[model samples]
Target: MKSQPSLDTSPKVSDEIRKTTCYMCACRCGINVHMKEGQVAYIEGNRDHPVNQGVLCAKGSAGIMQVNAPSRLRAPLKRVGPRGSGQFKEISWDEALDMAVGLLRPVREENPEKLAFFTGRDQSQSFTSFWAQNFGTPNYAAHGGFCSVNMAAAGIYTMGGAFWEFGQPDWDHTKLFMLFGVAEDHDSNPIKMGIGKIKARGAKVIGVNPIRSGYNAVADDWIGITPGTDGLFILALVHELLKAGKIDLDYLAQYTNAPVLVDAETGLLLRDGDGKQLVVDRVTGALTAFDQKGVRPDLRGTHSDGALTHRSVFQHMIERYLDPEYAPEAVSEKTGISAGKIRAIAAELARVAFEEAFELDQPWTDFRGERHEKMVGRPVSFHSMRGISAHSNGFQTCRALHILQILLGTVEVPGGFRFKPPYPKPSEIHPKPHCKVTPGAPLDGPHLGFVHGPEDLALKDDGSPARIDKAFTWENPMSAHGLMHMVISNAHAGDPYKIDTLFMYMANMSWNSSMNTSGVIDMLTDTDDSGNYVIPNIIYSDAYSSEMVAYADLVLPDTTYLERHDCISLLDRPICEADAAADAIRWPVIEPDRDVRGFQSVLCDLGARLNLPGFVNEDGSQKYDDYADYIVNHIRKPGIGPLAGFRGNGNKAGRGDVNPDQLDRYIQNGGFFVEHIPAGANYYKPWNMDYQNWAVGMGLYDSPQPYLFQLYVEPMRKFQRAAEGHGDRQPPNHLRARIKLTLDPLPIWYPPFEDSHV
Candidate 1:
C-alpha cells in the first residue's frame, strides 16, 4: 500500500535558504528562512546557534506570517481626522520626514527637555538612546520600566548582574533547580531546553509559583505560594537557613560584603579616608581594607572607636534574619505555605548545596591573590521573573531573592547561576542618571543609569522632578530604567512639566502597554479650555497599524523584522552565553514590497535632517547612510563599535578598527559571532582574576573590575540618611517617612500597599 501511494516526496521545499536572527520576540534566536522563487516559503532554527541550539518557538516559526501579514503599514501616514478616530492619509517618506523635523527642530533648538522620546520593546536602545542624548532630551527610556526594570535594577544593585538575558542557571551539573514566578512568555525557548536537559539528568525541580502551568507543570515539587508575598516567604527561608547554620560561611566572607564593618549608630559602612570599605582581619587582629591580600576577614569581628561602635555586616544579618518576625511559623499565614514546607525546602536546598557539593580540578586565582586548587561547586540554582518584581515591594523582594542565592554559595559557580559577558559589572561603574539638559546641545551624559545617592537624583534647583516621567526623583530614587509608562499621562497632566512633542517608537501606549487604556486614549485626545491638545504633537513609528497609531499626528511606517539590518550588540542587549561572549546581526533576507523604511534607518535620516551633533560630520554632512552603514562604520569608542566580532581587518574579537566587510563575514558565519571563555575563567567570574583579565581583554571592561557581591547595599542607606535629614538633597515631607521605612540597607519584607486598601 505504501509503495502504491508513494508520491514526489523528494520534491524541493525551497529554492534557497537564508540565515538570520529572529526578531519576533526578544529571544533573538537564529532562523533559516527557506525561499522559493525569491519569496519566503518556510522557516526553521539554526542548529549551530548558541541561544537555542536548533530550538525555535512558535513565535519564531510564525515570523513568516509577520513579514507577509496584510495588516502591515504600506507607507507613512498623516492624521486627517480627530485623535483616536482611526483616520489617516497615506504620504511619501519625504513628506513624513519634513513634518517630523518641523515639529522636533524647534524643541531641540529652544528647550530640548520639552521633547519626551521613549521606546517600547526596542532592540536597538544603544543607538536610539544615543540619538535622544544628542537631541538633548533627558526624558528618554525604553519599555523596561514597565516591563522588568525592578528585576534588572534589583539584580544590578545587589549582585552586579541579573537573571534572564544577563545570566542563567548552569543546567549541565545542577542537582536542584527552583523556579519562582517566571512568566512562561519570557526567554521561552532556552529555558524550556534547559529544563528538558535537567529532567533528562534526573535532577529535582521545585516550582514556587501561584500558578501550576507551563514549566511548573513538569516540576518534581510545586509550592503554590500567595502572590505579592514572595519577599516574606524568601525571608522565612533565610531565617531557617541562618538558624540551622546551613549557609556557605567561607564563600560569604571571601566573596561578599559579609565581613565589612558597619557603624552601628549611623547604620553606614565604615570606610577609610580614601573611601575603601574597612573590614577586620581575624588572622592579624587588625582593621584593614577588604581587598588586602592574605587577609582572612572575621565575620564576627567588631571595634569601638569611643564615639561609635562598628559591627560586621554578617552580625547585622544574623540579628536581622534570626528575629522571630521572619521565622517560618511567623510568615506561614502570610505566605500561604506551611511552616513545615518552608523548613523542608530550606533543608533540601542546604542538602543539595553542601552534602552533594562537588569540585572540578581546575586551578584559578582570586582578586586577593589567593589560589584555589579546584573549582568547588554547589549544585543548587534558582530563577524568578515579573511575578516577584512587578509590585510595589518588588525591588526589595528581588533583593531578597539574590541574598538567598548568595547564602547558598551558588551564584557564579560551576553548577549554579552564571553571568554572560559584559556583566558582573558593579553599580559603581555604571553611569548616574543625567538631567542637565542644555538647549541646542547634547545631554550632559546618559539619560538612564544607576543613582547612588540623593545627590544623584534628577531634580531642578527647586527640588521638582527634572524629567517628564519623574524618574530619579525623591518618589523613586533608584529608577535605573526611566518610567516610560508615565510619559503620556505626565505630559498630558503637566505634572512635572509639559512636553511639546511626545515622540514614541514601537510602543502601543493606548493599548496593552499602558495601565489605564481608556484614560490614555482620553489623554491623547484631551484638550484644554483653548481647545488645543494638552500634549501638543505626537509622532509614532511602528511596522504594523497597532491601536496607538490612531492617536499619532505623524506615523512613520517601519519594515518587517526580516527586511531590516539590526545588531544584537555587546554594547546593548547581547545574545551572549554563560561560557562564551557572543553577538548577532539581522540583515534583510528579502526586500519589503511596501514603501516603508526600518525605524532605525528612518531615525538616522531624521537625526541628520535635524543636524544632531552625533549624526552629522564636522562639515555638516550625514555621517551614516542608513542603519546598515551605522552598524559597520560607527565607532562608539576608539576601537569599540556595536558588534564585537570580526572587527579590525576582520580578525579581532573585541577591540579593533572598523572592518568594511564585517557584514559579509557575519553572513558567512551564520549571522553571529562567539568567543568561548577559557576553562580557568569560566566559573566564579566575579572575583576570579582569570575571568577579570579575560573580560578586560574582550573590551567588556577597561581594566579588571573584580568586585564583591554586595550582600550589604550601602546606596540604599544613603537615601535613608537623606530621609533622616542628613543630606543637603532631602526627600519631601510626604516621601521622607516612606523612604525611611522602605529603603533599609539590608533586605526587608513588607506587605504591598494594596494590602492596606484591602
Candidate 2:
C-alpha cells in the first residue's frame, strides 16, 4: 500500500473517439463520444466547437442513455387493434415502406392535401418541407406553432432576426443585460456561459418573468410581472423612455422605419411610383425614397396632399406611446409592476445605453453610402423567448419587446444583442405561404412562410382553408409557422377539410404536445359510424414508443441521434455564433443495433418509391441512397446544398459544386464548420454594407440585402386594411372586427382572450 499500488492517475477513457453534434437539446453542441470496445464509453463537449466551447450540459453528457434507452422502438410496427390500444405487429422495413407508399401514393396522385405531414422540433426541416412540397401537400409544417412561432414570426417581421436560435446578447461587451421570460432550458449552454462571462465582468443582469426561478433567480434584479402583461409592461417602458427623450433618435432615423412617412388616414406607409417607401428629407425638406443616398430622414417630418396627411412613423409613435394611456401609472395595475419600478428600470436602461456607452475602433460602410469613423456602442442588451410568446397577445408582446430594444438602439450594435448570419434578411425576401397544390405534381412553392397580406392567405378559390391546419386563414392570418397544433383536431372535426392520412414525425400529439391530451387521444382513436377512424389513415415516425405511436396505423421506427445522419443546414436552423456563420453535421458514430432507420433516410426511400421529382433521377432510379447522400449531392441552387462547408475540392465555405468528401471533411473538422465574419462586419449588420457583401458571398443572401428595422410593420397593416373594407380579399364579417383590432401595424397591448371569456 506504499503509493496506492502506484495507481495510473491519467487513465485512458477509451480506445477511440468520435466527434458529432449532439441532439439531446436544440443547442446542437459539438461533442466527442468516447468508444471503448466499439461501444460508447463517455461523452464530452468538443473544446474546438464554436458553440459551448467544451462545456457539455447534463443532457448532452447523458446522450449515451438516449442512444441505448430500453424504450427505443426496435422495428416498424403495424396496428393490429384499435387505435391507442398499444397493440401492434412488428413489420420489416420493406413491408413498412410498401404500406406507407400504398397509403401516400394515392393521396399524392389524387389530392395531396389529403396527406397532412408535420414534424416536431426536427433539425431536418428544410429536407422535410422540400419532400412535402414535392408530394404536393400544402398541409405541412414543423412544431413551431406548438413552440415559439409567436417569437419567431414577430422577430422576423420586426428586426429581420429573432432571439433564441437566431441571435444572442453580446456577453463580452454588454454592461447591462436584460432578459424577459427566458427559461433555463432555452439555449442552455451558450446563455449559461454568457451569464457567467457578464457576471465575471461585474455587469448587471435584469430578469423579467412571472416566475422568479431559472435565470431570474441569478439575476441582479428580478421583475415579477403579471402573466400575459409583458406587452403592457414593455410599452410602459417605451412610454417613459419616449417621454424623457431617452430614445436613440439618431439611430431611429438612420436604421428604422421610424423616419418613414405613413398615411395618417389609411394607416399605410407612403410610397413613391416604384413602390419604394418615401421618407421626408430633413436637409432638403423634400420627400424621397428612404434608401436614397445623402437623404437625412426627418423623424418629425410631415406631408399633406389635398384630402390626406402623412406623418413620420416616429411622430405616430410619439403620439401613441407618449399619451397618458401608455403611462407607467396607467399600465401599472395591469402589469403588476409598480410605476416607480418601471420608471427606475427605464432610467437605468437609458443610463447604461447612453452614459456608459463605448465605441470600437473599427470603421465600416453602411448601405446608404455612409461611412462611420468608429463603431458606436450602447452597452445595454435585451432578450426574450417562448415565455412571452405563448399567449393570445404573444405576437404583439414580442413586437413590443423588440420595439423597446430598437428604442434603446441596442440591436445589432456593440455591447448589445447581435444577429447571427443568415438573419437580418427582411420579410420582403422570405417566401410567402403557398397552398397551390396540383394532382400528382409538386406544390407551387413552400408550404409555410411569412404572409404579407390578405392576398397571401392560404385560401382556396371558393374561400375555404387551403391547408388542413387552417393556417394563413383570416382567423390566423400571420401563422408564419403554420398551425401544427390544429392539424389533428381540425382534420378530425373536418372543420376546414378532411384528410386521408395524418402523417407526422417526432411530434407526440396524443400527449404532452396537445393542449387537451385526452381530447386529442379521443380524436386519434374515435371511429365514425362506418367503423373507420375519424382521421382515417395514420402514419408516424419516431425513435421511441411515445404516446402517439399507439395511435398510428403504421409506425415507422427511427434511429437514435448517434445512429443517424443529420444536417444543421444553412437553409434550416443553423448553429451559428455572433462572430461566425456556422453549420454542423451528425453522422452515425455507432451503427444502430436494431432494424430502425433514420426518419429522413426513410423519407428518401419513400420519395423515390413515390417518384417524387427531386428524389428520383432522369431514368426514374433513386437519385440518392440515403440522407447522407442527399446532404452531399443535392443542389438547392446552382452552387448551394444542405451543408455549406467543404464544397468543391474541400475549399469552399458556402457555395460550390458537390464535394463527395464533404461529410468526411466535416468529421475531420470536429463535425462542424464555421466561417468567421470579418471584424469590420461583426456588428451593425442590418445596415452595414461590409456585412451585407459578406453574407452575399456566403450565399446567406443572393445579393446584399440591407434593410431597416421595421418598427412600423407594414404587413400587419395590410391585413388590417383588408378587414377595414379596403382590399378585395376581405376577411369574413364575423372576423373583420377582430382582425382590425389585433393586426395593428404598431405594437399594442391587449388583454388575454381568456379574460374576455371569464
Candidate 3:
C-alpha cells in the first residue's frame, strides 16, 4: 500500500531518428526512419536530401506497410509439391545454397547458355549482370526492354542522354513545358517537385498525353492526343516550325551533326579521302574536315564536292519531314488533335524556345576554348515516357521527340533538358556484348552491353543467336535492354533453345506483368511429351508473396527494406538530382526478427558457392563476406567502388581509393552524399570543359572529348549495311530487310499497328 502510494511515473523516451533511403519503388527517395522504443515509429523524407527535398511520393510513404506486410516470405523455401502448387517447406540457408549450386553448376559446365538469369525492378543490375557473366550465361537482361528501352536507347543514340534519370527538365527556368505520356513515371517525386516549381513560376504547362491525371491534372491545358501517335504529332510540330522558319541555326551548327555532310548516294556519313567526315563551309562552300577549326557550317543546303554530291544532314531533314503527310491537316485523324490546334501549339513552342530564350550571366569556355560571356537556353522543355515507348514504332517515336528538342536547341542549356551526371558519353559509345561461350568459365565481360553492329550479336558458329532471348540480334538490334517480356514464352516454346533454369528476381511474371496472364501461367506450368516440366527449374527471390511466388521451385525470401543493406550506386541509376550528383545507401535500422536475407547478400553467397570469377580472392577464398563487404571493398575499377563518396586517401570523392569507412561515412552523413556541382559546371555540359572533366573524374565517361549530338547515327547505318550482306555480322536471310528498315539512321514516322491494319 505504501509502495503504491509512492507512485513513481516514468516518461516515454523520444524516438531515435535513423536515416536511410526508401526502396518502396526504384525512386530511391531519402527517408529518415524514426525509432521509438527500438521499433519503427514513422518515416519522413529527408529535408536536406537533393533528390526529393523533404517530400516523398505515395510509394515512398507506403514503405512501412510494404516492409511489415504479413505476406512477406520469412525463410528459404523449397517446393515439396508440383511447381505451381505453392507447396514449400522451410530449409536452412546452407541447404538452399547447395540446392541452387547443384542445379546450376552442371548447366554451367555442360552448357552455360542453358541458364537464363533475368531481373526486374532490381536496383543492383551491375551486381546481377556481373554475376550472370561470371556464371557464363549469355542470357541476361533487366526489365527495361519492355518498359522504357525506347526512351533510353533513343535518347542515348540520338542526343547523348536519356530520361530514366540520365537527364531532367530545368524546372527553374522552363517557360513552356510539353509533356507526353509522363503522368506517373520513373522520376515520380522529383517530377512532382518539378511540376510544383514550374506551376508556381506561372509557366505554361501542356500535357500531350491521353489521360489528365497526376502531373496532367496540374497542366494548364491537356491536349489529350491519341496514344502511339506522338511521333506523328511531333513531326507535325516540326513541319509547322520549319514552315514558319522558327529554327535555332547557331545551336544546330555548334552542337549537332546537322551540319555534318552525308553521302547522298549511300545514305551514309560523307568521309574525305583520309576517312574523316566532311562538312561544307558556310562561307567558302568548300568541303572541309568536320573537325576543322574556323569552319562555319551551313546547316540548311545541298552542296557537291564534284565526286560524292554530299548534302548536309539538315538538308536531308528538310527532305524527310517537310512533307504533306506530317502537316497537321494530314495527321489530325490519327493523332486526335485538330490541325489548327497542332499548328497553334507548334507556334507556341517556337515562340517559347527561340523568341523567349533564357540567358545566364555566368562566363564559361567550350571544349574548343571558345569563351562565352553568357549561357543561352531555349525555354521550351519536353519529357515523355511509357506511352510513347511501348509501341512497336517506339524507337523512331523517341527519336522524333529528340529531334524536336534538338531543333529547338533545348539540350544542355539554361532552361533545357540538361543531362545528369555520367551521361553525355560519346553518343551510344557502348562496348560489345559478351557472347563467347565456354564450359565452366565466365565470359570475358558483363553479359548485357550495347551491340553496335552484327559483330556484337550472341551468334553461334552457324550465325544463329546464341542467347535464348534473341536480344541484340537483327530482330531487335537496338534492344540495349534485352526483351524480358519474351523470355517465359520463348523458354516454354523452346523457340531458341531449352534452358536448365529460369532465375528471375522481383518480376511478377505469372500475374499482371504478362500481356496475357493466363497464357504465361500455362507456360510456367507446361509439361513436355516426356512428362517432365519443359522449363526444368525456376528460382525466384521476392520480399512478399507475389503471384510469381507460387511458381518457383526454390524461393529465396528477401529481407524487408528496413532490414537490409543496399546501395543506389552511380553505376546503376544513381538517385541524383539535376543540380546534385548524389548516391545513397541503406543499412539495417532494425534487425530482422525473421530469417530473410537481402537479395544482394544472397547473390554474393551464391557467387561464392559457384566460385564465379570476381566473387573469390586470388587465394580462392570468398572475396566478400556479404553485400556490405562487397560494397565497401569490391572495386569496380582502380579507384572506384559502389559508393562514390568518402573515397580516396584524402577522402576526395568522385575519384577515390576504397575508404574502409565508406559505409560509415554514408551513415554519418544522414544516409546520402552529394557533392555540390559548381555553377560553371552545371549547364552546357556537352562541351563544357569543367563539366566534362568532372564527369570523367567521376568515371561517368572514359574520355573528355566534346560529345557531338548524333542526329545521324552511323552505327544503325552499319547494321543496315550488314543486313545488306556487307559486314562480318550479317542477319539471317529472312531478317535482313526488316533490320534495314528498323535501323534507319534518321527518324521516320509510320502508322501504329492498328492504324496500319485499318
lDDT for each residue of candidate 3 in 1-758, tens digit (9 for 90 to 100): 45555654765443688999988777788898878888886788999788887898767877778667899888999999987788999999889889999999899999899998998877888788888988999998888886889888898888777775788889889998888888688778888888788889889889988878878898998999888889899989999988888988898887788988877766778778986666778899887776566777778646674775777888878887888988999999998999999999998999898888868999988875777899998888888888888888889899989999998889889888888776766544666677787889997776666766667776778866777878877787778788888888989889788898999888888533456987888898889889889999999999888889888999999888799898888888787766668888989999887888999899888888888899998888888999999988988888877788988763677778878888888998988989767888888888888887878787777778675688878788888888887866667788777777877888877766656765
TM-score of 3: 0.95
* Candidate 2 residue lDDT tens string, 1-758: 46556779999999999999999989999999999999999999999999989999999999999878999999999999888889999999999999999999999999999999999988899999999999999999987888888999999999998897789998889999999988885589999999999999999999999989989999999999999999999999999999889989999999999999998887889999998888999999999998999999999999999978889999989989988998989999999999999999999999999999998999999999988989989989988888999999999999999999999999999999999888877888999999998999999999888988888999999989999889999998888999888888899899898899989998997543466988988888888999888899999999999989988999999999999899999999999989999999999999999999999999999999999999999999999899999999999998999999999999998889899999999999999999999989999999999999998888999998888899999999999888889978878999989988899999999998977776
> Which pairs of residues have clashing backbones in candidate 1?
none
Q: Candidate 2's error at 513, in angstroms?
A: 4.5
Provide the clash count, candidate 1: 0
Error of 2 at 502 (Å): 0.9
Q: Cα lDDT for residue 420, model 3?
A: 79
Off by over 4 Å in 1: 1-5, 510-513
- Each model's total of backbone clashes: 0, 0, 1
Q: Whole-model Cα lDDT per candidate?
A: 0.91, 0.92, 0.83
Comparing candidate 1 with candidate 3, which one achieves the higher lDDT?
1
lDDT of 1 by residue, 1-758 (tens): 45676699789999999999998888999999999999999899999899989899888999999887988999999999999898999999999999999999999999999999999887899999999999999999998898778899999999999888889999999989999888674688899999999999899999988989988899999989999999999999999999999999999999999999999877888988888888999998899998999999899989888987799999999999999999999999999999999999999999999999999999999999999999989999888888899888999999999999999999999889999988888999988999998899999999999998888999999999999999999898888989888888889889999999999998887643365888888899999999999989999999998888989999999998889999999998999999999999999999999999999999999999999988999999998999999999998887899999999989899899999999999999999999999999999998999999999888999999887788888999999998898968888899889998888989998889877877
| lDDT of the structure predicted as candidate 1 | 0.91
Which portions of model 3 miss their true places by more than 4 Å? 1-14, 272-276, 301-307, 511-513, 754-758
Per-residue lDDT value at 397 in model 3: 93
